[model samples]
Target: MNPLSIERLKVFPPVSNLDPSIYGPQDSALKEEQIICHLNGMSVQQAIEENKLFILDYHDVYLPFLDRINAHPTKKAYATRTIFVLTDMGSLKPIAIELSLPEKNRNGPPKCVVTPPVDATTCWLWQLGKAHVCSNDAGAHQLIHHWLRTHACLEPFIIAAHRQLSVMHPIYKLLHCHMRYTMDVNAQGRQLLLNAGGIIESHFFTAACSMEVSASVYQNWWRFDMESLPADLIRRGMAVSDATEPHGLKLLIEDYPYATDGLLIWSAIEQLVQAYVHYYYPEANIIESDSELNAWYHESINIGHADIRHASWWLKLSTPNNLISILTTIIWLASAHHAAVNFGMYPYGWYFPVRPPFMRRLVPNERDPDYTTFLADPEGYFLASLPCLDQMLHYISVLDILSTHSADEEYLGDRKDLSAWAGDPEIVEALYKFSMEMKKIGKEIEKRNGDPNLRNRCGAGISPYELLLPSSGPGVTCRGVPNSVSI
Candidate 1:
């Protein structure tokens, strides 16, 4: 594959009023003005057609912006929104709760929120950082660096009130626009919100997965599952504590036989398992046997993971049995009967909101392990690659297409013979050869003849010299096959 030619995911193109051409001087204020001008021309009819609006201010654009940043993250691409949303007025306290987006972490400022006494009447403006102050309604003329900061969790409440007045999604039941939201103002504000997509929020899910994985490894367990397996220790070549001075996952790969290949194969299996659980079982906690799987998942927190993923965990973790199969029938209910009448389409149910039905059933147990006791202890946490989540995105996109009325075309051409040769035949041959040749290799992992030497050898590092060695099999593998095929 040509690296330069392969276009990585560019899901949401940052726009200034739907036009990327408006970027000028690399300064934010000029760009905001361009966006506001662009929105002033928008209409409700226009919004329904495009199905996207620029976010205005801090309150309403929370998770939607998070989704955008997660799609394609970079520091430059992420910060542009706060530069506009937190614009200050009158040297008063800033509106947002974050004091400042610290330059320390590339992922985000910190995992938190802000809350205060803000109503529709409160006239506040942005100060430097994530703070806000009272304003006289004139534009932010200058900057103030003295404003204090708060956490991320609390900021949404006041902003939530403000979003109450913005453009309402017909399907979003709670966001009923105030009468002040004229046909004019709503159109303008929504466009600003759409343009502000990549900014205003952090990629909290990516950060959460990284943190949880690290914390789990640091704790010498996978907290999401409460299993009692020595598999974790054996796989890592270390115990729960580092008193033995044994190696962990890093050493296992470097020194163990087939460590790299086994890990890669295991990694792919993990993805397949996750997908199976999420799609087929739909309510099962498939990874719960890992002992600490749930702990690192941080199941109590509302944000930082996909709703479908979180809800699936909640369903399995809470019930552990009963009525699981029945829930899948409502997956495409379009918000239910109450939702349709309330929001004028279908009611945006509680499952999609802050207080989903599963929250009450969960009894959170955030047990922080003391990793310092481990010998030769690692100073930080474990971080797993999130290729699974990326793959899930592809799955959901395909699901969305299939769910729509427009997906009826035959995915293949009318004539199969014409399309058969389109793909590279050499790649096809490589796959066929690997599948056939790797057959005998699978048996060794399952081999157990009660011989310590054979057990150790089977589990030990694979010899690099023996990768292409010819082996015998009774027509189940590449038995007595020639090694003429170059990999």
Candidate 2:
């Protein structure tokens, strides 16, 4: 730690008397005991009673010829009585009186008491002392001391500034409102979809009835009444029991209203994708491309459909470029569908647009108005959105596969300099085992979907699009059921 300076003064007295001329005139004035007592604001009796006086001595040497010729010979050494006293406030004040004596050898010069400066505000000083005690090293002690002193002085002002900014910031209220709404919807959705006795039956019903009535009846029966079926058929049906149902056009349109629901989902997905790309690969051209896409979409109202179609194109692309884009799209769409089911369908401009009627209604004191609206058969919408959730999970699985493959490829590339046999055998074996296991799993998944072309990327590698196929299960069938009612 850096040295600290404090208010202090030092006094040096001369050795034994030699007419006071050789020693200097200033030394003459320091010889009187009364002066020392007067300087410390104490009488001789008070100083003696307090026992604050000390006699210090040190040997000294002068020129031999000058000392021998002197009438009053200078002694080789001398002693002085040093007096120390403190003010009522604990400030150190001292005085010294030279008691000239002829001495041959004595102790060294008297030690001076270095006083530390008193702090006006003792709280910060106390904090600094605490910091010093807690610090493990000299550097840490100095840093803590500096930080405490610096920040403690500004703490009040900083808190006041933060409070002012919170109120003045335009996005603060909007973000808080949106966050509250999202959390509420999430709680309601989890209760409806994930609870044991909530929507499980409805979910299963929708999954089971998603396919053609005839095929579904047969497939559903083999699993639902497993004991009545033949052993071979029952075994086969058991293998497909975990299948997921596909999201049909009717269901998509019903759950995702084009203007309000679809647009919000689309915008959210775009924002999320841009945020991901900008954070991870800021120097990449993808940011510029996304910005261009956004500009094209906002240029005119007529191009809105084109913008959606353009963004959707990445969903079909079997390249790494579409990884985050497609995943975010599916996630936002699924979340929007979930929200719409739990919260009634509301207009697009409700809470989002600046100066909207809904914005005025979004106060901490009031309940969300859209949540109170009456809707016919809200449970059916929740059931319909369940398939969208499945689709979202499928996309997430594809993202996992892509991420794993990319990491594996990068790892292998990094070790390209090493011979295959020279590399860590365990790591190589682990990679090979993982690939083989994934292939086996993929084959089973294909069997459940009854699709030979699933995950087959033009004989190159597995395609992420294969996740779009319904997963294998009793609830899934080889064919889709026609919509009984118009969407």
Candidate 3:
């Protein structure tokens, strides 16, 4: 039930200022005292003040959809809120988990509340609760994080790029490599993975609630500005903006493999983008006068993602700096971000028990017939609650395919056709420098993976976090950041 790293941790009680009543359950099942003991003597407020307390909050997001999700006989889910502390070792230690079900009506509290178990039976029950929480996380990671953030959200940009930006356009040349196979992959996703009664709906815990939940997240949480690495970290409350810090942000947890390695890649990409954009649009007025660039930007915002066209966070493409930041964000999303979430799927989830996509049985209670059965052989009952054999195989097969890399896969900086862009010597040099930076970043990731202190990546049984390692040959090597979301 522990998160892979502190990157998954969000600041306690998110920055959202919504009324408490809007939340699923107003009361926290894990009390202050319960977490205080685990905080190494720091008070809850102290931890919050220090940015040490974090939460994997699935409560409000999943709560409203739980009723429809649980309607299926074999599929069940819970609205879970897990809180954790950033230990001195820089690992995240899960202190409490609050599993809740919706109230019959709006007037009452949740139908059920489960916390850490006090005794053996409740410990077994607690395991069941953790399983349910895992089920919720797995569904969210796929639908919201992988598909929505990296795949669906970027489709409009891809379309606008192709439709508005001419093939010979500098911006088109800059973005074309990152857009490879994206449309093909997304078309396949809609037809197979996300289709009605398809793999996602049939196998994931949310089941029928999958797309509805994904749409809800896109409506409520996604932002274009937050797509960048530093901005995203600050928004999650995992880091504080500090002028004196590296990357201009102080990480709350210094040993985060994804963030630590990704910041290096993000900076590299930003440098390459700034250089390229400056070369093409030397003056701010050049961006303003560019007809194709303006059309592409307008189409991406106004037509492609029309649902959130009026979003407050949309960046204006007026200045060279603005264009640099925007292009950097787009490239980062296509390469590092997608790779982090996608390529590691099979390595981390091939074992169904590690990250079960769905649970068959609900939490057994005294009111249910299975409660007695649960007490007699808790292990057996727990195993029964997991996805059936066929479903597990289906889940593994899908992940194995999604996580695998093709032989012709183009990594972040593997461009071999620099001769095509030789008309511009500055752009050619910039691309060459970017490729070299990627190689350095790849080596740094290898060195960090060997560091025993970063427990999330290195340890006796821990699989090194190689999802952002920048390159790979082929197959599910569990390392490699493809330029686009090919799978």
Candidate 4:
């Protein structure tokens, strides 16, 4: 017979009309006599190949068999066992039986089988299934399968993605490292990581699938919540406070109207940082400087005045390191904001305050600008954002490595050391490369806007923020007038 036709055969026997007369009086003896004889007639391989057998719990087969036997008018007692086999469809017979021996004698209900705990591999498979089902894409299915087969696991990839999301939020990289290294060590830890990966994977698949329909669909699915502001505003607002200290002096020198706006931008950056810190490292110490800065901001706003600014004083305070920190923060925020905007977030604005004005002017009307140009070219925006994403990924890798040993002692021994990591060759190199790429892309965006007159007016003319000099002793260098800042 053809294999397909053979697949249609019903191999197991029905027990609705079982005869009770064939068996002896004792239920246990009857069961043994009926089942063993049938099994001896056929091999296990034959039963499987011919699809002649069904595997199920003993109680499942027993209850129905008992009903049939009872219905016979001449009722007979049924065997009580944990496992049972039914065979011979023409002649209904309980073919084989096995009694379960409990390890300990205490139970309200008997279990037919004890399932093992889910492991990392099991979680990966579950995630893969969910991704495939949710996406319903052949390419995605094949990609997941390939990853599973090649990597022997998807934990690393999933964990990496999870780490990236964490960074995008206000979570500290150190705490994430701690969880991966110190907290989760055993099978339970591994399973938790797998579970996290599963969550990330679900969101990722959703975002991926949303991209297929429309940019609006994608943005809606991954949009960031605008209701609750990021905590970094409170935490990192101090940096802005310090930078804007010379605002009074800057105004005296040049009468720049946007100095307060710059303060606001810095304040927003702080909130963004605070959001991450609170989410990722709630236990982290609230620096007194931040509090002081918050007070300064409120006081400045209330009094409608800022103190002493030669622009040089602010420039001096803004040190290359501080500027880089601010830039890095912006990059991370942009990456997350880009993801949200790409996926379908409303407001459809870049996270940084500086960029939106320029982006707005790019359109025909600032009030009723058409987003078709912006929305249609998502891939370009995504490409523009890659450098920042790559930087975050690099940071995650560094953290993961540091987690393996002693992250605190090795990298964060002191406040100076913490800041020093910002200037590290690898990190600086990544940031520099990112700056160059953004400069290139920013120009492209500028050119695409088709407004030669408005080209450099919206602060798009600002030079890419670069670390003036590598760390030499303590002080940082700022080369320019600090007018135009590119992330």
| lDDT at position 122, candidate 4 | 32
Model 2 superposed RMSD (Cα): 38.7
Residue 262 lDDT in model 3? 88
Best by lDDT: 3
* Candidate 3 stretches greater than 4 Å from native: 1-25, 105-118
Error of 2 at 103 (Å): 99
User: What is candidate 3's lDDT per residue for 71-165, written digit by digit as tens?
Assistant: 88888777777787788877777777776777663312354455566799979887887888788888878888888889999999999999999
* Deviation in Å, model 1, residue 269 alpha carbon: 8.1
Candidate 1 matches the true fold with a TM-score of: 0.16
Ranking by lDDT, best first?
A: 3, 2, 4, 1
Order of models, best TM-score first: 3, 2, 1, 4
> CA lDDT of 62 in candidate 1?
23
Q: lDDT tens string, model 4, 239-326?
A: 1223445422222111111222232233333443444344323432432334332343233222321222212222111233332343
lDDT of 2: 0.26
Instruction: Give the lDDT of residue 60 in candidate 1.
Output: 16
Q: In candidate 2, how many Å is residue 254 off?
A: 15
C-alpha lDDT score of every prediction, in listed order: 0.23, 0.26, 0.82, 0.26
Q: After superposition, how far is residue 443 of candidate 2 from its true place, in Å?
A: 50
lDDT by residue for model 1 over 124-232, one digit each (tens)? 1111112111110000100000000001111222233334322222101111111112233224423431123411112122222222222223233222221111233
Where in model 1 is the C-alpha error above 4 Å? 1-45, 56-271, 275-487
Q: What is the lDDT of residue 315 in candidate 3?
A: 94
Full-model lDDT, candidate 4: 0.26
TM per candidate comes to 0.16, 0.17, 0.94, 0.16
Which 10 consecutive residues of model 4 have the lowest summed lDDT?
1-10
